[model samples]
Target: MTVTAAAHDGGIPAPAPGTAPQQVTMSGAINRALRDAMTADTDVVVFGEDVGTLGGVFRVTDGIARDFGPDRCFDTPLAEAGIVGFAVGMAMAGFRPVIEMQFDAFAFPAFEQIASHVAKMRNRTQGRVNLPIVIRIPFAGGIGGVEHHCDSSEAYYAHTPGLKVVTPATVEDAYTLLREAINDPDPVIFMEPKRLYWSKGSLPEDASPDAQIASSFGRAAVRREGIDVTLVAYGPSVDVAMQAASAAMGSGWSVEVVDLRTLVPFDDQTVVASVRKTGRCVVVHEAQGFAGVGAEIAARVQERAFHSLHAPVLRVAGLDIPYPPPKLEHLHLPGVERVLDAIARLQWDDQADALHLPESSPACDSPASDSKGGAA
Candidate 1:
C-alpha cells in the first residue's frame, strides 16, 4: 500500500510538419504536450477555471478545447476545491485527469483534496486504485504579478507524502515533463514557473513533437561544467544561476550549474556529485529560505559530500516576507545581482577562510531603498 514517488526522462513523439524542433516558449512547448497527450490518450481530460473558451489566462491551453471538444477539454466552475474533488473521482473511475491551477496562491483552495485524497488514495486503496492526476500550477515570482499571482508554493506539495513534485525551467522540459506528469500513475504537482513562460530555447531541428519521457525525472541535469563552485537552481531561478555562472567565469572562477528538475524524488546524487567536484555549493530558488526546498538540498549536500566541502552550503532565495507588489518586486525576488553577490561570498583562498563580519548591523545594504515594509 505504500506508494513511492517517481519521475521520467524527457521524450517527445514524432513531430508534425510546421511544429519543428526549433526554439519555442515554455508555454508553447506545454501546449504541444497537451495536444499530443490528448491525441494519445482519450481518457486524459483537462479542466479548470477559465481553461476552456478562454484558452486559459496564459494561452497554454489555447486551441485545445476548440479542437478536442468540450468533453475532453472543458472549463469548470470557479471552485478550486470542486475541480480537484471531481478530478479525483474521475481518476478513481479510470480517467487520467490533467487539471490546471490558474495561479500559485490560487491552488490553496484545492489543497484539501490534493493532500487528503489525491495524495493518499493509492495507498489507502491498497493498490486497488491509483490517481493519475497532473495538477499544473503556474507559479513563482517575476512578470510583475501581484497579490495571489506570484508565490513559490511547491514546498508544500513536495513536503506532502505520496505526491510527486516537479518544476520545469526549459522549453524542452516544459513539453517533456508535462507529458510525463500526465502519464504518471500517481498524482504529480507540476509547477510551471510563470515567469519563464515566454522564455525561449532551441530544440533539435528534426526532433519530434509528439511526446517523449526517459524516466530520469529524478536526476538533475548539469547546465554548465566547472570546478570552482556548484550553483544549484530550478524553475525560474535557474536562469539566474546560469547568469551567475557566466559572470563568475569572467572573475576567474569556473562555476558549475545543476538544474534540480524534480523536487519530490530529489536527485541527490547529481547535485552531491557536483559539490564533490567543486568543493562549494549554493542552492537558489524563488521560494523563501526557512524550511524551503533549498534547505533540504543544502542539508543533503553537506551530509553526503561533507568531506569534499570547502565552505558552508549557501542559499539564494526570495525575501522571507510576503510577495511584494509589482513595482517593488525588484527588491524582493533574487536576481542576477543577488546571485552574483552570494557567489562572491564563497571563500576561494586559504588565507580568507576566516569569515568577515559586517562593520555594523545595518539593514540598508543599498542606500537607494529602505525596507520599510514596502507601501506599494
Candidate 2:
C-alpha cells in the first residue's frame, strides 16, 4: 500500500490542553519516559532484540541495562514472534513487559502473536486476562536506511480490533505516551519514528498525574488551529504538517494540524470535532495509502462529519512501492511542500478562476475569523 495526502477547508480546530513542556529530542524523551515508568513500577520489564546490551539500535534504551540490572532490562533472541509472545505470557502472569522490535518491518513476523493472541486475550477471557504489553518498534523512512529497516507499518496493528497503536511526534509526548501505554491494561503498538529520534523537545520530570494519556489513545490532538483546512497526521508526518502550516501562513491559508497519536480505538470524537469545525480534512502518513490508517480515519470523518465537510476526505501517503534505496528516500517520503500543495488543492475554487482570480487567493476573509473558528 502507498501513503497519500488529502486536503480540506473550513476553519481551524482548538489546540489540546498543555500538561508538560515540549523541548527535548524524541529519543531523549522516550528514554526518560521509559526510565520513569520502570522506576515507578518494579513489575515493568523491558526486553527485545539487542535492547539490553546494545541499548537498542537508536539508543532509546541506552543505559537502561546498567540502571535497571540485567533481570529487569535484558535482550532476547532475534525472533520477533518470540519477543512478543514472551511479552504476552509475562503480562498474563502479572509482569508489565515492554518489548522492542528493532524496526517497523521486523514486526510482521509477530503479527499472529499480536493480532490473534495479545489483542484478543482480554476479550476471549471475558476480561479475566489483561495483556499489558507495549511493543515498541522504530518505524518510518528518511535516514536513508535499507528496506525492512524503515517501513511505516502502523496500519497493520491499528487495523486490529483490540490493539492500541500510538506514535509520538514530540519529546513531551514521547515521554508521557510511553508511560501511559506501559500502564494501560492492554496491548499497545508503539511506533517510534526512527528519523525523528534525534528531534528535540522538553519533557516533564515525572508523568502528569492528570494528563490525558487515555484521551489521545484513540483520538487526535490539534497541533495548530486555522480555518482554511485540516492536516491530519501522526508520527513523522506530524512534523511535516506543522512545517506546512507555517508555510501556508504566508500564503494567507490557515491550516489546522491534527495529530492522531493513537490509531486503534482511534479518538473519532477529536477528529470529527476538528473536521466539523474546519469542514475539510486531509490525512497523511508514511505508510502505503491502500487500506492504511489514513483510510480508516477518513472514513470515520466522512461518517461523523459528512454534512460539515466542504470537500471529500483526501490522504497524503507514501507510494505503494517497496521502501526505496537511500538515494530515492527523498521522493518516497512526504514533506511540507507536498502537504501545502494538498491544502491548496482542497481550497481551490474553479469559479474564482473564471472570474480572473489570482492563483494565490486569500484562504479566508480575515485572520480573526479563521483563528477563532476553531473548537475549544
Candidate 3:
C-alpha cells in the first residue's frame, strides 16, 4: 500500500455521531481506537516491544504513552512469548490487555501461550475465567519487508477453535473492529495488514463502530456489488479484489467484492448470498492456497450453493511456498492480472453447454469471452 499522507492523528478520538467525515489512515485509526478504548475502560492496558517509548515500529501507538501514561501504554522486552504470557496473566487478573506481537512471524513463538492458555482458559475453567485479550499482529506481505517482517499467518490463528481472527481492510474497520475486539469477552487475534498502514479513507464523524465482537461475532462487508461473479477476500487482499472488480468491468463483467472482515466467525451468509447471485466465486488472499482460508471458503460455498454455482469455486492466492524475498514478492502475491486470468477460466462455454442454458445465460453472455462464445 502507498502512503497518501505521511502523518497520522494518532490520539484523536473517534468523531461523534453526525460529525463530518474525516480523512484517516489505517494506522492512525488503530491508534485512535487504542486511545478511546483505554479512556473508556481503566482495565484496558497495551504493551509490546517498543510500543510505548518508540510508539511502535509503525507508530500505530504514537501518542498512546503520552495520552494514557506508561502504566496504561507501556513497553516490554523482546520476548514474544513473555509478552503474550503476561497478557494472559493480566486478562486472568481482570484486565483487558491488548498486546502486540510487533510482526507477523514474531507471534509464532507465543503460539503455545496463545493456543493453550489464552484460547482455552475460559472453556477450561468452565466460563469462570474469561480472557478478554487481544493479540495484535502486524501481518501480510506488500511493504517490501524482509523474511520475518511479512507473513500471512492468519490461518494458524483461524484454525484455533477458541480464538477469533479478524483483519480490517479499510480505515473505518481498522478503528471499529479494534474497539469491538477490545470490548469482547473472548480472545481475539487482530491481524493488521502492515502494507495498508498508510492507506487512507474517510469515516463518518457520527458513525458508530459496527463490527460486532461479542454478541454477533463479526459480519462481512460487501465492498462492491455485481451479478457476474463474486470476489471474496479479506485483509490486504480486499483492496486487490476491489481493484480486480473494477478491471473486470472492461470485459463486461459485473463483479461483487466481499470482505470477510472476521475470519473466525466466517460470514457464510454474506459470501454465500453473493455467490448464489453471481453464480461464480473466487477467494483471494496472500496466504498459501493449500489448506488456507480460501480452501475453507471454497468448500463452504460449494456445500451451501453448489447447485447455484455456474462454475467451480476458484482461488487467487499466494503460492504454496515460503515468503519470498522483497524483490520477488510481486510474482508470489496475487495481482489483478492473475485474478483476471482466473476469472477467465470459469469455464464459460463449458458451463453453458453442460447446462444447455439459453444464449442469455451469464456464462455465454460475458462480453470478454464472446469471441469464443456459445461454441457448442
Candidate 4:
C-alpha cells in the first residue's frame, strides 16, 4: 500500500454559520468523530500501532497526535495483544480508550483479551466496573489486500456476548456510529470496511459530531425503498447491494436495500418489516457464507417473517475459504452479478409453486394477494 502525507488538519472542519452541507470522505468523517469525541470527553484517548505519528495505516487518525498531544494519541509497540491489554488497563482506571488493530487478521492475537476481559468485564464484575472501550478493526476484502490484510471477521465478534459490533457503510454513519461506540458503556467492536475508507458523502456543514445516540444507534437504515425484494447488507457490501438495487430497476424490480449498521444490536424490526413488504429477501456480505452474519440474518428473517415470505431467504456472500490473493479477490467477493443472481432466484412465480404447495391447499394463498409486484 502507498503511504500518503497527512493532510494539514487531517479532518474536515465545521463550516461557518449559514454554510450548506459539505462533502466528507469516510476516513475524514471518522477522524472528525475521534477529534470531536476526544474534544468533548477528556477521558477519551486514542492509541494503537502507528496511530499517533503516522495517523494510522489509512490516516484515519491523522493529525490527532499533533492536535491532542502525544499523551492522548500515542502509538504502541507493534504488538496487537499488548495494545488491547493496555487499553483494558486504561479502561479499568475510568478512561475511555479507543484502540485500533492495524488490520482484520492482525486482531486475532488480541481475541482472548477482547472476548474475556473487554467483553465480560461488566457481567463478570456484577456491574461494578464497565469497560467503555472501542476496538476499531479495518476489515473486509475489496482493496486487493493480501491474506493477512483482508478478512471479514465480523461474525466472530458478533457471536460473542457483551460486545456490540457495528460496521458503517457510509460517510455519515462512519462518523455517527463511531461517536456512539466511544461513549457506549459496553465494549464495542467497530468494524471499519477498509475498502470504504475513501468513499464520500454529504453531511450538513454544522453537523454535530458529538450528537448523542438517543434512539438511532442500532437501527438499520433503509437506503433505497422498494416493493419487490429486500437486499440486506452492511459495511463494504452495502455499496454492492445498492448497485444491485440500481441495476434491478432496469428489469422492473424495485429492490430495497437495508444497511444493518449495528450487527450485535441488530434491528430485526426494520429488516423483518422490509421482508414482509417485499415478500422476498436476499442477504449480501463479503464474509464467507458458512455460518457468517448472512446466515444469522437469513434465519432471523425466516423465523419472524415466515408467512410473509413468498420465496425462501437467500444469501450472496464470499466463498467459504480463505480470502483470495489480490488479483482474484474480486471473484471471491460478492458482486452485482452475484447479488442480482440471488435476487432472480427469489422465486417470483406464484406462491404455491415457490413454496412447493398445491394451488388448492389451504396454506397456499392466492397469487393476486401478494404485495405489489411480488410473487404474482
Candidate 5:
C-alpha cells in the first residue's frame, strides 16, 4: 500500500500531558504504539520470526497480525539478515517496516544488513532515499534466562554512525518512543529491556503531542536532579541507578539520575550539565565493562566536565565474561549494591562530611586511562 503524507500524519493522538495514566505493562504499551501506528498509517508493516501467529517471543506484537491482517503484520523466516534486508528494501520503496529481533543476540546476524545498508543508505544516497525502518530487539539481563537470551548490545548500535539507538525505561516512553521511531525519517534501533516487559506504568488514553515523549534525538532525560553525585544509566541499569540513589539518600547524599533514552547521538549536554552540578558521576549499564556504553559516557563526562569533577568518573557495569548462566547472572549484572559501592568510593575522603575527591588519581586524567571503570 502507498503511504501518503496525510495517512502517516493522523492517528489516535497522544493524550495531553499529565492526563489519566492508562495503567499498562511496558510490553502492552509497545503493542499499543505499534497498533496505533499501523492503524494510522497503512504503509506501516511489521514482520519478524513468529510475530504473526505467536505475537513474538515476548508477545510484544501480540494480536497485531489479527487486527491489521497478514499483509500488514506477518512473520518472516528465521534469517535475521534476510529480514533486515527485506525491511530495508521495503523502506526504500516508501513503506515503514518495523522488524523485530527475537532476542538481543539474535540481532547480531542482522548486523551486516543494518550497519552496511540500513544505517548507511540515506547518507550514501545523500538524502535521495531514507530508510525509515525500526528494528526492535528485546535486550538486557534479569529474566533468569540463559546467556544469549539476555544481552545488552546498545553500545554496538550506538557506536554505528547512522543508526539512532533508543532504550525506554518507563511505560510512558515505551509507547511514545516507539511511535516516534516509526515516524522518524531515519532508521532507529529500538532496544527494549526484556526484564521490563511486564513492568507496569500509566499511559494516556487520548493522543496529545505534549503527552508524547519528546523525539529529541541523542538527548538524556533527567529522571531526578540533585547536587551531590550524578548517576548515568539506560535500560535495565536505570532501575539499579535509581535504587542506588535511594540508598545513598539514607546517608544524606542527594543523587541525580540521568536516563539516556537515546544512546547514539547521546545527550552529552544533559550529562555534562548534571555532572557539573553534582561534581561526581557514575555511569551504569547492563552491558559488559569492555567498550560498553558506560565507557563512552565516562569518557564524555571527563571531556566535558573535567574541571568540575570532584572525583574521577566511575562506572558500574557487567563483568567481562560472557553473560553467565541464569543462576550467576546476578553477579554478571550490576545491581544497587554495586552502584552504592561506587557511590561510597565517590564519597570517600571527604573532610567536611560532604562528597569529596581523593588526591588527583590517574583516572582523573582520561576515561581511557582506567579500564577498571571503562567497558568490560
Candidate 6:
C-alpha cells in the first residue's frame, strides 16, 4: 500500500502556562489537527452536513472553512451516502478527503458504501488504489438527544473487515489520532466521544515528533497506573473509567485506567500487560455489554492473561436495550457507579479494605435532554 504522511516542522513543543501541558478540550484539539493537516497538504478536503457554515453541530469545524476557503473545507448536502461515496472516488483519484459524520447514527445511510466500497477498494483493487480517507464520527450516549444520536455503533465498523476503527479518549490523542488517520493508506473510522468533546486536558508543549500510537495501527494508553485492578475503556468510557478509578482510590483500592485509543487493531499488548500486572480487569463502554467491544476485550484478556488473572474479566457496559431517551439514559449507559460495581464483584486477594464508598459521590452525567442534535 502507498501512503504519505503530513510533515510537521521541527521545533520545541510547548505546554501550558507553566511547565504543565497546554490546556485543551478534545474538540479544540481535533480542530487544531484538521487545520494542521489541511495546511500541510492541499489535497486534504473536509466536508459534511453543516460542517462548513455551522462549523459542525458541535462547532468543531467552526473556523475551518473561513480560514481554509470553501474549496478546501466546505459543507455538503444532507446526504451521508453521497458524502462517503464521493469521498471514495476522491481518494482513488489521489485526494485526501476527510468526512464528518455529524453524529454516530447519522452514518447509517452511508453504511453500504462504507462496508462495501470505501472499506474494500484498497485490497479489492489489488493495491492499485489506497483509500486514505478519515470518517470522523461523534458517538456515544450522554448528550441526551433523541434516538439515533447516542448509539455507540463502533462495533458495526470494527466488525467490518478492511476498515480500521479508532477512538481517542484524550485531548492529545484526539489531535494526534485524527492526523494519523488522515494519513493512513486505508479507510479509518475515527470515532470521537461527543460527551468528551468538552472534556478538558493539556497538550504538553514538549511533545515527541515521531511518537504517536499509530505504529501498530492501534495502541492502548495507560491513563493511570495501579497494582490492584485494570479498568479498560475507550472514548467517553475513558472519562467514566478515570472517575471510577478516582473513586476506587478513596475506598483504599488502587485502580489503573487503560484507554484503548484504536479499537480495530486492538491494542492487546498494553491491555494484557495491565491485566497481568493487576490480575483483574473490568472493560467499560457505552455499547451493549453483550457482544460489544468490551466482550472482545474480556475474551482476549482471558486467553492471553489467563495465568495472571485472579478473577474473570468483568464488563461495565450499557444495557442491551436500544438507546434510551434522555431521561432514562443514566439507567442504561455505563457510569462510574456501574464501573465501581463491576470492580466490587471482582475477587481480590486482599479483602482487608472493603470498598466502602462515600454516601454521596459526584455525578458524572453528560448534557442529556438539553443537548442539541439527533444523531448518536
Q: TM-score for candidate 6, please give it.
A: 0.85
After superposition, the stretches of candidate 5 with alpha carbons farther than 4 Å from their true spots are 1-19, 208-213, 350-376
Task: List the global CA lDDT of all models.
Answer: 0.82, 0.79, 0.85, 0.87, 0.83, 0.81
lDDT of 1 at 169: 81
Compared with the true structure, model 1 gives a TM-score of 0.88
Deviation from native of the Cα of residue 136 in model 3, angstroms: 0.7
Sliding window of 10 residues with minimal summed lDDT for model 4: 1-10
lDDT for 354 in candidate 2 is 20
Which of the two, 4 or 6, has more TM-score?
A: 4
Local error of candidate 4 at 285, Å? 0.3
Q: What is the per-residue lDDT of model 6 for residues 268-316, given as tens digits with 9 covering 90 to 100?
A: 8999999999998999999988888888888899999999987778889
Cα lDDT for residue 151, candidate 5: 88
Q: Residue 141, candidate 1: how far off, in angstroms?
A: 1.5
Q: Point out the higher-scoring one by lDDT: 2 or 3.
A: 3
Instruction: Estimate the lDDT of model 2.
Output: 0.79
State the lDDT at 323 in candidate 1: 89
Ranking by TM-score: 4, 3, 1, 5, 6, 2
- For TM-score, candidate 4 versus 5, the one ahead is 4
Q: lDDT by residue for model 5 over 1-376, one digit each (tens)?
A: 4333333232233445767756788998888788777767788899999998888999888877766678998999999999999999899888999999999999999999999999999889998999999999999988998877888888889889999999999887888888889989999999999999999987655533224445666778899889999999988888888888888888778999999988977897899999999899999998889898888889989998899987788899899998899899989889998888788776344322212334475434433222222311
True-structure lDDT of candidate 3 = 0.85
Whose lDDT is greatest here? 4
TM-score-better candidate, 2 vs 5: 5
Off by over 4 Å in 2: 1-23, 205-215, 350-376
* Tens-digit lDDT string for candidate 4 (1-376): 1112232255676777777777888999899888878877879999999999999999999988887788889999999989999999999998999999999999999999999888899999999999999999999988988998999999999999999999999888888788889989879999999998988897534456456645456699999999999999999999999999999988889999999999989999999999999999999999999999999999999999999998889999999999898999989999999998888767675543434567777666654435423444
Judged by TM-score, which candidate is best?
Answer: 4
Candidate 2 residues 1-376, lDDT tens each?
Answer: 1111110011111124654444667887787677666666778899999988788998888877766679888999899999888998899899999999998898899989998899899899999998999999999998999999889888778778888888988877787789889889888889899889988766654443234454446656899998868889999999889888899888788789988887766787777888888888888888888888888888889999999987778888998899999999999888777776667656344212121334355633223222322211
Model 4 TM-score relative to the real fold:
0.90
